[model samples]
Target: MAEQTFDVHVEREFDAPIERVWAAWTTPDDLRAWWGPTGFSCPRAEVDIREGGSIFVTMRAPDEWGGGEYHSVWEITELDEPVLLRYIYRFTDADRNVITPAESGVPAEGIPDEAHHEVLLTAVGDGRTRLEMTEHGYTNEQTRDMSRSGLDQCLDKMAEVVSAQPR
Candidate 1:
């Protein structure tokens, strides 16, 4: 029997420095500004941010889109200054209790829970940062695509947020 794997990888270039890009992900205020997709709003942001710590976000959908909050926790596995980060993404309840994909209204197959993620950053010239995000181990195609779309939008918003900040 072969195990199935679905993965997502997205890359973006920011006009800001690698430190700015890293701050967008690590700072709670910056995270709250652009944590979700285009139509989604982030209402809550909390972080510990060390190698064994976690980042938590409450992503709120718009009222017109059937308002709901999706809570997520990223358990940090590795932290390397402004260049790299590794974490495990998980759905969680309001109290930050981990939930399975099914419990989170995700239609998953052949997997119980969790996705491993890595964020890589490189300085391009003096004031640009090339960023890459990789998420591995989705259970199915549909789930992977849905996640990818959200991630893309999040990065899009991140670029905007970082660009607006003074370098």
Candidate 2:
């Protein structure tokens, strides 16, 4: 039998330069400004931009959306300033305790404990930057679809942030 695979690829072009886009991702303050979906907010962000460093972020849902927080961690595997970033992502609790998808109220049928995600940034000339994000290792199609939708919304928020910047 063949193995099943699930992945998501999202790409977008920002009016801001590559440096600005990279800062938005590496700077905690800039990241918190637009790290989640429209109705979600990033209350905290801690980033260490290095090959072996880690990033932790707290995403909080609106009052109407259960009013809880979800913590996520990214173990940086590779970093090339303003160009490429590779990491493995995992969910955690408020105390930084690693948690499974079921523990976080997510269906656990095919969701892996950790997934590899990567971001590629390119200078598209004329002060524009192109970002390509890919995340994979999902065990089930449902989880992948849901994650893709949420990621799309998050990227939309990021675009809004980039657009408001002083070019």
Best by lDDT: 1
lDDT for 129 in candidate 2 is 96
Deviation in angstroms for 3 in model 1?
A: 1.9
Model 1 global lDDT (CA atoms, 0 to 1) = 0.88
Estimate, for each residue in 8-108, the C-alpha lDDT of model 1 and write its tens digit.
89988998989999999998999999998999999899999899999999999888977888888999999998999999989899899999766865454
After superposing candidate 1, which stretches have Cα over 4 Å from the reference?
106-112
lDDT score of residue 112 within candidate 1: 35
Each model's number of backbone clashes?
Answer: 0, 0
Summarize candidate 2's per-residue lDDT along 84-105 as a digit string, tens digits. 9999998898777899867876
Q: C-alpha displacement of 118 in model 2, angstroms?
A: 0.5
Span of 10 residues, lowest total lDDT, candidate 1? 104-113
Estimate the overall C-alpha local distance difference test score of candidate 2. Answer: 0.88
Q: Which residue pairs does candidate 1 place in steric collision?
A: none
CA deviation > 4 Å runs, candidate 2: none
